[model samples]
Target: MTYTRSEFPDTFLFGLSASDPGDEALTEGFDSFRFPVHWQQVLPRGRGEPDSGGLDHYKHLIDTVLRRGLRPCAILDSSTLPDAIADLGGWRNRDSANWFAHFAETVIEHIGDRLFSAGPAARSWTVGKSDHLGTDLRAHARSLHHHLLATGHAIRAMRSYGMTNLGVEFQLDEPEANTALHAYFHGEYTKDYLAKFSPNLPKNWQRDFDSIDEPIDWCALNYAHFKDLDGSLPWSSLHREDTGETPLYVVADLGSVENTENLLGDIRSDLAQGAPIKGLFAQAQEGECLGLLQTALSGGKQPAPWVAPTKALHGHWNMVADVGGTNTRLGVVTNGHLDELHKFPTGSLEDFQAALRRVRDAVGTDPQAVVAAGAGPLRDGVIQLTNASLTLSRDTLASSTGAQRTFVINDFTAAAWSVADIKAKDVAVLQGSGSPPPGTRLVVGPGTGLGVGALLYSEGHYHTVSGEGGHMGLSPRHRDEVDVFDAARRIAPECFFADSLAIEAEMFLSGTGLPILYQAVCMAGGQSDTPTLSAKDILQAAQSGADEFAVKTARMFTEHLGAITGDLAVALIPVGGVFLLGGVADKNRWLFGQEFLDAFNAGGRFDDIRGGLNLYVSEMDEFGIVGANNFCKNALAR
Candidate 1:
């Protein structure tokens, strides 16, 4: 079931839970019913309800989601509906079909208007019976079929009503029907229930149902079986056993991480009976769930041509570094771009040694003609490491000659190669909506460490610019920010940039900048003892306008970012505009849009310079990998 990442689609579902509670606070009741449900817990009663401008909420939510290049799929929950009191088990007063039809209309009226939408359907949700209804196979079966047929009909009806783009999906959705042996032993039902049901199922089920492993589209009955044991046990105990086995220890309630190993164990029985099942809804883990999800979702996204990519001319480089926290691999491209080839680990000297050894072991040559002294810093994070702690290779050298090929170089310089290359891969983020003549581009990365660089776009190609832009002066935008910067300066006054001889610019933009900012805000707000907040905490405080320091920090961070972007804009005249790179650019996009944009466009009379200063929030996570590859491809060829 485990396949390489290469096997998966470029865009696959990476949904994060966002379930919120609705009428009656029925989260516990739904679980009590012994069915899987989406308990999307969100602050301030999740998005879009009737009072929440129902239809408008749906449109805005979906549109905003797709705008980020992520497809949206709604996981409908019983909690979403207005609270109503009804008897347990099929208790909606009106028929279940009528209830769902109403729900479908609310969804389609807004979301279905979009041609690119795939589904607004419920995910892994049951169609019948509350916990008090008890266990009834016939009822479960009848309710499931009824919901599917009704939902399908409702969708067709919606289409008939001119909402042709509406989509409806059904899941088998039964957790009580795991192993026959469990039903026989600990199931709430007596032996008569199984004895009657088994005989009703095809006569061949008992002998071969357990072994059937063919891919079956059981949309009529999306099975959630997660255990595989050939023994008798109570349904409750069996259910616990099935959920307990996991690759990683998980704390789940009703709808939580479990197995998909034997998810559809009994679906074969129904398939053999000529049942028309269409898809599955298993919570995959390890390799099992991945296959089920991929296989079932092979249909892919619809309404093509969603994005447009411009032409990019690649180039080569002399060096590269793997600035990753783990699986670090750096390389020097003596004859090409750093990405196309591998750079030995030179973020640290020991890394340098190991990288050298890897090459020596592979090529069997310790040549000594060119020694350009390649020594990486003996440090990591803010914690300094001795040379002994670093990985060393025998023949790793930045120079062709080994003797003098070991000297200190900026890790940011190595990091810049990839950053600049990423700017080349997708320049639109910086280039803006309409095409601009290729111009110089700026790349700023704020991750575990802050990395900033600029790349020249000339003659339709990118030329990497090497400079310590991040190490420049810490230009505080607000008085509070200035105070915070001064406070941090007190802690490490000697931490100014060296050789680069730049003033500390990271007081508000780097990883080191965050803690300093967070502390200052908390202390100023008189919440200094607020549990030693993280940078994220400070930003959260600002969102609520809780602390002046936090608001100040957020403003300062954005404003400084704007100043940097503006400075780089002037330096490169990046006719192509400016690009905010690294993890920070992507995660804090809202921040960039508000503060950065406000500041970037504040260059006095030169504000017009920002007219085409294409600002973009990159969605590509593999920019480094692909950028490096692109760099390698272009450089090696050159």
Candidate 2:
């Protein structure tokens, strides 16, 4: 006689051990169990091309479990992949990202009505070692990027097939899950640090899944032990050595408990001071652990403190765009990491939509959001490009890129946010630097024109402050500067003249301004043989030391820039940090040595104010795109 689901109680027993179906699980008195549906078993080739012989094997296994009154929860992949895809560089390859999606779609198509919940992947963590996902990266940031790429792809693909119940299972303290920044985000990094840290998750693997907005039917913690050296156990032991300053404690006991009293106490301690704990799950054997938890939960008198996890932006790809007058730079941002940077010439593209289409095609998926930083002020959610024949608006941007959320901001505003998540290699310190002192950080640059903004750090949040500060008065200090300012007032084209004898700071500092300074220096020095040079030519000549007039022109520019920087330091009082950005600072970085420092620190009575400020030159070209991405992330999280 064949057994069936009706023969046993609704809560019958079963557990899956390796590939042996549910026979041992049934013997162990477990009601429900999960099993792996290896991708290699279904489509040995990794693509949609199916191997019929391999497909039938998994179908028979599922049918066998059902016949024995066992509930089958299918985990689509145990990080398994076909050899073909693994050979092609696995998850690191953009093409392989879709492999998980294809495999998920195929699995759901075959077992659409059978699964209790369709789980596409398990333990979706990345590190430097070669793992089941076949991705290898020494950097913690890169691993996370590809990890999200694969997860997002599979999630979108599975949902497209109409499978309602989907979830992701994760292990919190897995050894490989704790890489440099990976460990830092998980409330663990250096044990010898001076701060008594807490169990707060600055970053979590769950966010990648949550961002997709796919409902999690269940979360299975692979191993329930929390007493290991790296585990979140004994709650009190999980902290850095205390600094002289008192640190806010955030640790909690996340271990499996036996009785109801201890369990309630453990949870209440975590919620003692409004620290958020979304949900608690027990992963012990069914009798003592499950019964006590069920009884305690059922008999609760007052409502339990229920705090949900951090809500994330929707699970679509996020695109960041930095739009200049001549060209636009676009890249896809996932989990705060940017990749696949591509350039689009605005001259060729008919409109913003044309540029967006090229970006969308390059990404090969619809973006959830697009954060754009354009070289114009954003007014009423729209911006008219200063150098191009395009107007960017949120409404049109969303329609063009198929992004659910769209944000357009001033280019300088975007530059301010880029500093928040800057990499070490991206920054080149010019003067007075260790770590940034805590306060407001300033970003001012000269490209087509002078751009100015500040990043305010208050209450653990970043606020971008920007205005028409670029048009501040240019006060001449030295004789050369006085001559240059006077010459700029006279020879300045009619377009640059604001009023009688009023020379704005940008007239001697910006890309266009650099040439004006060179011509003024030629006039002041009476060098009649000096050829008329463009800003680019002057910069090149100065860098090569080929033209003395060009060298003096560059020097006069820096001296004025340094003095203006000192003035801004006095007004804004950004003791935290100061960033010099754009092509002007980066191209002639050689000029920022002693002469520039001397001029910057020449703030007379307030010389200490400018001298103490940490200064950095941003070498990144697409810093605006980075800022826009962060702006979108923060805005959405809010």
Candidate 1 lDDT: 0.42
* Tens-digit lDDT string for candidate 2 (1-638): 12222322232222332354544333323333366787788888888677787678777777766665545566666365578876776554556556677787777666745665556543444331247323222233334444444555566565544455565544435544322222322323345321322232224534443333333444333333443334223322222221111121111122333333353454355445332332343343344444444444343232322221232112246888888888888887776778668787766335657878877766555676788888777799888887787787898777787665789898888888878766557778877765565678888898788888888888877888866567787766765466656666666746344664446778778997777778777877776555777888988888899999888888778887887877787788786678899888877788688888888888888888788888888887678887888888888776
Give stretches of model 1 more than 4 Å off: 1-327, 330-395, 398-431, 434-437, 458-461, 479-482, 495-503, 524-531, 540-548, 622-638
Q: Tell me the lDDT of model 1 at 478.
A: 58
- Native-referenced Cα lDDT, model 2: 0.62
Distance (Å) between predicted and true CA of 600, model 1? 0.7
Clashing pairs in 2: 13-30, 14-25, 14-26, 14-30, 15-25, 211-315, 212-315
- The Cα error of candidate 2 at residue 410, in Å, is 1.0
Residue lDDT tens for model 1, 1-638? 32222332343222212222222222110111011122122112222343435444555555544454433435333423233312323422225444554454444444444433222232222433234223555544344333333344344333322342233322213343343223222322335545644433333333322212111111111222324423211322332443222111111111321333222333333334433332232332324344443443344441232331222111112333343444344443433423234544335555555664564334332321111211133232121222224432223443322321232223433333444434334543533554333566566777545666666677767765555566677645555454555555544567644432223666557655777666655555556464565667767877789876777777777777777767767666776545566666666665776557767777778888775577654455544544443444444434
lDDT of residue 584 for candidate 1: 65
Task: Identify the leading candidate in terms of TM-score.
Answer: 2
TM-score between model 2 and native: 0.53
